[model samples]
Target chain A: MSLCVLEKVSKTYTTGDLVVYALRQVDLTIDPGEFVAVMGPSGSGKTTLMNILGCLDVPSSGRYALAGKDVTAMDDDELSRMRSEHIGFIFQSFHLLPYATALENVLLPTLYLERPVDGGKSRALELLSLVGLEDRAHFRPNQLSGGQQQRVAIARALMNDPELVLADEPTGALDTTTAAGIMRLLSSLNERGKTIVVVTHDPEVAAYARRVIRMRDGVPTEQPSGRTPRPLTAHPPVTP
Target chain B: MRRFISSLHQALKAVRAFKLRAVFCIASVALGISAITVIVAATEGAYRRAYEMVDRFGPDAMLVLGGSAEARAIGRRDKTITVQDVEALRQAFPTAYLLVPMSSVREVNISYGNRRHQTRVTGTTEGYSRSWSWPVVDGRDLSEADVKGMRNVALIGAQVARELFANTDPIGKFFFVRNVAVRVVGVLEERGTTGAGHNLDDRIVMPITTAMKKLMNEKTYVNAVRIRFLDARNMGRYRQEVRAFLRQRHGLKPGQPDDFRLLSSEEIIRFLVALTGSLVIFIGITGVMALVVAGFVLANLFLLSVSERSGEIGIRRAVGARRRDILFQFLLEAIALTLVGGLLGFVLGVAAGPLLKLAADFPIYFSWKAFAAGLILSMLVGLIFGLQPARRAAAVHPIQAIRSG
Candidate 1:
């Protein structure tokens, strides 16, 4: 079964007498173990599409399914559960709680679980180490550099061990070298059988994916990635 | 359960992050709770004082005053009950255990070896000790010889002993009242202060014969007469009979208001409760107002933080926190703040007993019931005011995690 299936999903915003179509009957699908990039300019409805794909929001019309379960008909509570159990989201700004340490941020999802995961503490520490932030687990967001803060956020995104990872401009706040390092990490996770979807307007970021979906004026067109695919375990040129 | 604890932990961290504002919020809750505690303490003290006084006065006792209470309120002073009235009462109540007559001069300067103290000086018979339920801690009680021979001997109250003697022993000491010298033969036990702040232990008592001969000069009228009966169940019947007998003895005409008043333990309790009723009610109103004001301060405090922490709320929701979780977090914050205030107020209220005693002779006592009630009341205030802030916190859109700061 597909990891996520969106059929003619539409989202509209109504303000006073004006109606704006953020997403106009956009249909998309994400299969397991696939790396896809969604490229769109500002106001192209890419954020709204990503929100629906990640189950952070529901569509105004049409159907959305995640892991074989319908999502558009789910209430806010079920949407929260779907996001927690099946998908992980990463934002460009990191969105780390200012008062929480890196480890605490990683453990945050466990707090909302029906029964918080046993050995979750060790798993949080392991994820931090995987993101090269083991030593910074006790540090708050402000104490870390931008790259290090993003690394902490990435570790938190992986803490729940979700199969689908959704990132929205994950490297937008980082330098070119740091952005490349983050893309490499996402690439490595994709190779480990995680279905990854990255949203960005930058072609450089989109080039890392195997398939590219470009959105123009609320319309999406599919294309084969320009670069040849590397082996599943193949190492790319990476920087820390 | 873990989620609830996590929410509480988050609430504590939020409060700790901005301690100055937390203090501002807690002040109103503490003020209201402290006032509540004081009111409870005052009320407890009033009833407790009445109970103790009634016990000392005895259940089967009736006290007849020389003037009517209603008339005294309008500044009417009647010197109607005289020595002859006491003799008449003794004859009327043949089953009475004791009948004692007393006359006291308030605010008299008494001196011993240049150490001076002002106190009430009372003149009474030898049965004064038995009738008042007062016992001597030092020396001996007044004997029949003292009243019959009109000796210049006296018994000192606890407070008068403390003031005049300090570290010196009061027994065998000589104190003078208006140039009439009397040697103290005994020191009375400590009786503390009354509910109205009257120091019951601040007086000197001497034989009526000595006071009449040396100080009063005219010995015809006395201030009050006390009679103790054999059975407490018959006090109501006895009270009526005594009223009729006194009126007849005084030749009081029908419809002409009797110039004297009769009192019992029940009457004393009613008067005391009535006297402290206004004070208790005033404190109660202020206490409730304080709680209400504190609730607003707390609600406003949480509201401000909810808006300020919108980003944080969004992050939490995105990480899978349900609306109930967000609601719990804010509710926990409110309850935690008010509980701290309740604790502070309870401690201050308990300590106020000693402090107030030293400052104003305020009667107070510690009651766990009142403390528990205050705690419950404070928690209620938190729940009532916490709803709006928690709901607002939960209403924060999860999309803010990607958008807002």
Candidate 2:
């Protein structure tokens, strides 16, 4: 079964007299273990599409099934629960709490969960080690480099073991080499059967996914890669 | 429990970040609470002092003073309280233990040889000594002959004797008051202040007959009469009986109001407690208003905080925080701020009690109830004022907030 399904989804905003369509007539589905990239220029609605899929924003008019649940019918609290349970987000700016250590930020989601997740601390440490930041677990976000911060964000995204990872320009603030390193890490995560959706305007960033969906004027066109997306061969290994 | 701790942790970090603002808020609240505590302490001290006075005077002690409804209506002060009234009261309450009619001349000039001083001169019967628990320490008290013969023998207070005669023996010393020769027969024991800072030992006691017939040449008048019941248990009944008898003797018809006022030591204590009670309550209300204003300032500060941390709030929302979670987080932050402020206020208030006593001789009582009230009020004010900002913080759209940042 598809992990996410969108049927004729549309979102519109009325600013005074003019109506702006952020997303329009979108039909999409992602099966388990799929890695998809949404690419578009600024104002092309790629972020809006990612937001809808992540359950951060509901479509103005559409039917949305997230993990086979009717997401379109959910209220704010229900949407929050869906986001907490099934979706993990990686933002472009690497939004780590400035005052909190890397490890604490990773454990933040579990702290807000309805039921206590047993062994949450160990799971957070394991995710940090997965991202090769276990040694820097005690370092605050401001103390870490851009690459390390993005790595911590990646670890946090995986903290809940969500069904889908929505990364919105995850490496947008990083240098080329660091971006390549992040892509390699995401590729490994995808290889481990985590369904990952990356939203980016950069072609090089989108090249890491098996399938690319290009958005223009709130609509999408699918372009299936002929072969598996290549990970950077020059990047360091996953294990430190 | 974990969530609560996490939220508390986040709030502490926020408070630390805005250290100056937090300090100012706490200080403002502390000032208000301290004021409340000081008033409570002072009033409690006054109440205790009044109670002590009542105990000293004994429960059966009663007074009939000059200023009554009929006296005020008649607009005559000199003859309002008369010897006749005292005689009538004694006749009515024939079994009374002791009754004394007393009057005073304020700021009278009295000279002993070269040393001259101005002081209060009280005139009364010999019953004044026993009725008020004042005893002569040197020489002898006045006899019945002193009053009947209208003699000029005087009982001087310790303070008056010390000021006038210095080391010279006061007994048998002659003093000229109103240019009339008066012999000091006794020196009364020292009585301290009246607790209201009035000197109790700065007086000269003389027989009422001398004061009325010789010095001032006034007759048939006394300022007030002091009475002690023989049986203490009959005090309430005697108090009512005296009032009724006096009203009849003065020919005051029903509803015409009493020509004289009857008071007991108990009534005086109750009056004083009520007076101080209302004053303390007024001051308490003012302090509470100050606290409410502080709460408003706190709420305003938190609202500014919410606005400043909108990006962080949005981030939390995206990461799975429900609206209620955000609300709870901010509410907890407010409560934590106020409770800590309350604690600081309580400490400051407790400290101020001794300082106030040192500075102004004001008494302070620090009860657990006042401490708890100040703290609980702090929390309650925080919750009331912090609600609007917390709700605003919770209502932000994650997508819009993220984009705005």
Candidate 3:
């Protein structure tokens, strides 16, 4: 079954005297274990698409189905529940709570889930070990390096054992070496049969995905199965 | 239950993270609570002590004194109370518990060997102790023989015992009053100072006959007549009978004013009690104001905390904390702070009572109700003032807050 399906989804935001279209009649679908990357320029609606797919924002008009459940008309509480149970998110800034330790940060998502995840600490430790940060579990965000903090954020995202993971510019703020490490982590998680959607402006970062989709303005220009795209350095990028 | 405990742990952690701010907030609350409790306890203590003192003067006793504005205006200053007036009141009101004709000789100097002191002297019948509730501590009170034979004898006060005799026993000792030596037959127990700071136990009591015959000389009148009613509630009837007897004995017409003032001990107690009650009310109101100021301090502190931790709140929301959870957490923090302050304040208030007694030279009693009031009031302050800041923290938008950081 398809893990996520969007049918003619659109989103528009009105700011004072201007109306900005964040998404325009977008239709997409992903199978249960596919890895996809969305690439676009600033204000090209890639983040907006990630927000809707992550259940943080609803589409202005269209049907969004996640695992055969229509979530287009769900309220705030229901959306939160859906996010807690079915989706996980990683932000570019590695948004770990500053006051919480690494283990405490990883345990954050489980706190909101209705059902308690068994062996929560053990699972959190396993995720931290997977991200190569088991030794730094007690250190706060300020005590960790940028790369370490991002790894902790990734571990936090997977705490609920979500079916799908949404990462927005996951490696945007890291150095090239650290970025490659994060990309490797995401590729391995995707290889483990988790459906992953990553949004990035960097073609090199998007190169790690198995399937890449490009966006111009608010419209998708390349289909997922069109081709095995060349390396990021060779692609002729277009600005919206 | 685990969730509640975890939430409390998280709240305590948050408070500990900002230790100086938390301490300042709690201290402000504690100061206000302590001030309120001490004032309330002190007022209640003073009122209770004053009531006890008034009861010592005999709750059922009434005093009739010669007084009339119209008579004085007409130059009737010689309308003094006679022994006849006392006999008349006793006969007219057979229900009276006791009747005594009394007079005071203010500031009389009495001497014992080389020691001398100026003291107040009261002369009344042998029933004075029964009517006034003054019990003798040593030897006997003035007997009927002393009164009828007009013998020179005296009942000294506790302070007089300490002053004239030092550590020696005062019973059967001779003390000279205006060079006429009188034997002290009894020493009365101590009565604490009055509201006016007069030492009530620093006086001498002599028989009315001896005082009339020897000191004042050929007296046909007394300064005051004291009557004790069989029942305290019969004060009004007893007072009416005494007024009527005096009016008839003085030969006054129907429209003529009364020649004496009938004052009930109940009235004195009531006046003092009411005055004490008003003072307590005033102090209580000031205490409330101080607690309100403490509440405002707490509110301001919480507001500053909410502003400072906006980013943290957003992160928690992003991790799926509901608005109600955030609100409850902050409210719990506020309540915890105030409750701790209230507990500390109660301890300090209780400890302060004896210290205050030592400083003010008067006994200060503590009331449990006052302590309970302080605690309940502090909790109420936490609820009323803490809600606004808690709501503000809960209302933050996760997306906007995340962007702010």
Candidate 4:
């Protein structure tokens, strides 16, 4: 079964007199354990697609399903629950709460759970270690480097063990070396059987994914596979 | 439970981030709360004073003073409450234990050797101590021989003894009231001020016979009679009998106003308590007005905070915080602010007691009940006023809010 399925999704915003279409009628499917990259220039609606997939915002019109659950008609609270339970998101800015320690940010998702997650502390520590930041768990976001902060965000996203991880320009703020490291981390997470959908305008970042989708003016079209398909364990290109 | 605690933790950090503003908010709330605390303490002190007065002057004792509405209205000083009324009251209530005829002159100049002071000088019978429930702390009570012989002896109050004699034993000392040398036979125990701020200790008492025959040179009359019943339960009945008997003896007919007024210690205490109670209510209203203003300022501050932390709100929402969670975050921040203020105000209120005593010579009492009530009231103010800002924070769209920052 597909981890995420979007049928004829569309989103529109009315700014005074003109109506801006952020997403057009687009059908897409992301199967379990699939690594997909969405590549487009500015204003190409990649962020809008990531929002719809992550359940941060529902499509203006279309049926959306995540992990076999219908999310098309969900209300705000229901969407929030869906996001909490099934989706993990990494933003371009690494939106870690500045005042909170890295460990506390990783523990943020469990704060909203209906019941306590068994061994939640150990699990959060393990996730931090998975992202190679277990030693810096007590450090605040400001105390950490950009690469370290993005790693903390990745750990926080995986705290709830979501079905799919969504990244919208996750390394947009990092240097080239740091960005390459983050893409390698994403590739490693995908190798470990975690589904990932990353939105990026950088072709080199898209090279890390097995498949790529191109969007133009809110319309998305799939590119032919195997152009720059690298093995999961292959080293990312060393971009100075 | 965990979620609530986490939210509280978040609120604490937010408050810590803006320490100055948080302190300002707490101070405003503390000022409002301090006003209420001061009022509560003042009224408590007044209540204690009233209780002391009622205790000192036995609750059942009645003071038949020299003035009547008609006498005062007609500008007549005919000695309405005299020794004749005392005799009639004694005859009417033969079971009465004490019927002390009394008179007083305010601000009489008294001198002991070189020291001189102006104080109240009361003239009453040998039953003065029994009727007023005040015991002589030193020396002996006046004898019947002293009254019959109209001896020039006096009992000084604690304050009068302190001022006139200082460390010297006042018993057997001579003090001249308006140049008439009177020997101090005893010293009364220290009693604090009255509810009306009358210094209870700053006075001296002399025998009515000596006062009428020698001091004032007035005979066959007294200013008032203070009566104490053997069985206090029938005081009302005996009081009425005394009034009727006095009216008959004074040749007063039906529809004629009697030339005396009956005052009870309990009535005086009640009047004082009611007066202080009204003052407390007035002070309380002003305090509440101040709290309302503080609440508005607190709400405005929370609104500003919400706007500043919109990005944080969005991040929490994206991490799975519901609108209610966001609402609770802001609400808890407000409550936390007010609770701190309430605590500080309670401390200020309690501390104000001694300051009031020193500044105005007023007594103050602090009760934990008042402190707890003030705290609860302050928190309620936070909750009520915090609703609008919390709702505003919760209503922010996660996508847009997260993007803006």
Name the best candidate (by DockQ): 1
Candidate 4 docking classification: medium
Give the per-residue lDDT digits (tens) of candidate 1, residues B116-225.
Answer: 88888888888888887889889999988998999999999989988888988878877898788899999888988765679899999999888877877857988898
Residue pairs with clashing backbones, model 1: none
- Please give the lDDT score for candidate 3: 0.80
lDDT, candidate 4, A125-192, per-residue tens: 99999999989989999999999999998998899989899998888899999999998998899989
In what order do the candidates fall by TM-score, top score first?
1, 4, 3, 2
Interface RMSD computed for candidate 2 is what? 1.4
Two-way DockQ contest, 2 vs 3, winner: 2
lDDT (Cα, 0-100) at B8 in candidate 3: 70
Q: Which portions of model 3 miss their true places by more than 4 Å?
A: A5-21, A24-26, A30-32, A59-76, A110-119, A213-222, A225-240, B57-96, B99-101, B106-119, B143-149, B162-175, B183-187, B190-200, B216-294, B341-364
lDDT score at residue B108, model 3, on the 0-100 scale:
86
TM-score against truth, every candidate: 0.81, 0.76, 0.80, 0.80
| Predictions in order: lDDT | 0.85, 0.84, 0.80, 0.84
Each model's backbone clash number: 0, 1, 0, 0
Off by over 4 Å in 2: A15-20, A225-240, B50-61, B66-80, B92-194, B197-223, B227-289, B355-361
- lDDT, candidate 3, A1-240, per-residue tens: 778888888999999989889888888877777778999898888888887887777999999999788999998777777888888878787888777899999998887776666799999999999999999999999999999999999999899888899898888889999999998899899879888899998878887786787877788766432343434432333222
What is the lDDT for B227 in model 3?
Answer: 80
Comparing candidate 1 with candidate 3, which one achieves the higher lDDT?
A: 1
Q: State the displacement of the C-alpha of residue A160, model 4, in Å, after optimal TM-score superposition.
A: 1.8
